[model samples]
Target: MAILLAPMEGLLDFVLRDILTRVGGVDRCVSEFIRVSNTLLPDQVFIRVVPELLNGGRTFAGVPVAAQLLGSDPVCLAENAARLAALGPHGIDLNFGCPAKTVNRHGGGAALLDEPELLLAIVAAVRRAVPKTMPVSAKMRLGVHDDSRALECALALEGGGASELVVHARTRADAYRPPAYWERIADIRAVVNIPVVANGEIWNVQDALRCREESGCDSLMLGRGMVTNPGLALAIRAAMAGPDASPAPWGNVRPDSSLTTSPALYPIINWQVLLPFIAEFWRLVCARLDRRKQAGRLKQWLNFLRHHHPEAERAYMALRTLSEPAAIGQWLALQ
Candidate 1:
């Protein structure tokens, strides 16, 4: 029951990866996609995208991290993948599932699904460029608009020497919509002999179990579910480990001895654990963008957290009114 953390662009940064890896049950982490183009990427670009490699290709806590690349050009992507492999990461994952209009417009992400042969070329080029021992994998949606060509796409990747494949159970058109067609993933599993990881709509332990049952996949990848419930990986692990096994609640403190035993306590505790990470994230964003831009990014994450974690609302309100990081830290402390 391997659980790989999905590489969500803006949400899953180094800070969050560090936090989640320390929480137990996650088998591996994939860094957000590094967009490649015609130009050679600067070393700093690799450093920023996969800083974990600085400390042995693992998160600060030693969880293995893989570098993921996104691009449409075979030559450019292969060159970048070779350079990244030289950096000594645990693995290299290619992204062909992103649905962003800008990415697709450039023929980078899911847009490649429209040309399965090109996708195969890119994977083959990358596999040839990287070391034979270094694992090469890919993640993709069923297709650009339908699952009709999914088998062809999976077979193409497999034919190109991809060590494994992760199938997000929806077409690019479905984008994060309801009822992910796990059956489509099962279809892909049947056609490919390599490891197939089922991904999509897995928001809880039950969902994870049902996904594996329906997709007949031995592994799984989690994205938005982890954003809403940080403990989801642990829950899935406990469920898969044994029916009698129960995971300890978050916060590292016993529930009975917690300062507040209220049913709502978990959300608050989650916020406490998350605040420092969020603050660090804001600082990193500020270093790369303007203050207004950084605040907008922070607000966006807080809004997502608000849906499942009550403290997110309070934290968002307090941070929305403050421009300085110190003030935000103070407000978080007071919570």
Candidate 2:
């Protein structure tokens, strides 16, 4: 079973990808979506979004990274995908699942689900542009407002030569509400011949088992869950494997444990144990981002980390007011 890191735009950039994959159990990662519009994007754009492309499309930990493109225009997507492929990305992924209002307003993301024909045309065009041996994939929600055309969207993407499909298991209208309809993914899997990866609301090993059973898919793509609990991927990987497989050291979890953690009872990871992760993130951001932007990136990570550790919230509060990256770095060190 493959476990992929979802391409969360403005988050999950190469620095986070490096950290997560180093924690172990991530097989592939899709880079944050590169927006394609009327013009073909420059090589630097791809490099900026997916520096893994420069490292042979693999993180330092050796996990492959796929270049994801988001756009409504088929030709532009194809052009960009071709250029990205030239840089040796491990694969190409078409993004039709972004729920941001700004993106959908531009005829990209989930909005394309309304026009299955156009979506398929864009996928087919990119598929044709990339090397025949390279893998091309697509990620989509159930539908725009409802799941009426969900199967059609899945089939259209598959027919357009998508080697695999990742379904987020919600309609555009449902946008992140509770109770992802994983069963819908099973219905889509029943008809499509390519690998179907189930995504959305998988928070633990039990959740993974239930999602797999309900969606009838072995592969999965994890997003927020990975951030909330950085060790989730490793924990789930251990659970799914035979007893002989190595045990995950970070989180000691078993099937009998609750499937999800309430915020009140969320495990408060010790500040000391988490310090290294925070430090590494700060270091990497310092290397990749401008000095002015580093503090914002640190805040972004703390925003996600706070969900698991309340101390992170306290740290965020301390650093939130700090503007200088060096000051933030010093603050993290003092912790």
Predicted structure with the largest lDDT when compared to the true one: 2
Error of 2 at 102 (Å): 1.5
> Cα miss at 33, model 2 (Å)?
0.9
lDDT of 2 by residue, 208-318 (tens): 999999999999999998877776776676666646654333453221122122111223235565577678878888998888788898898888888877888999899
Tell me the TM-score of model 1: 0.87
CA lDDT, every model vs. true structure: 0.80, 0.85
Could you give candidate 1's per-residue lDDT for residues 97-183 as a string of tens digits? 998999999888888998889989999999999999999999999999888899999999998889999999998999999899998
Off by over 4 Å in 1: 246-298
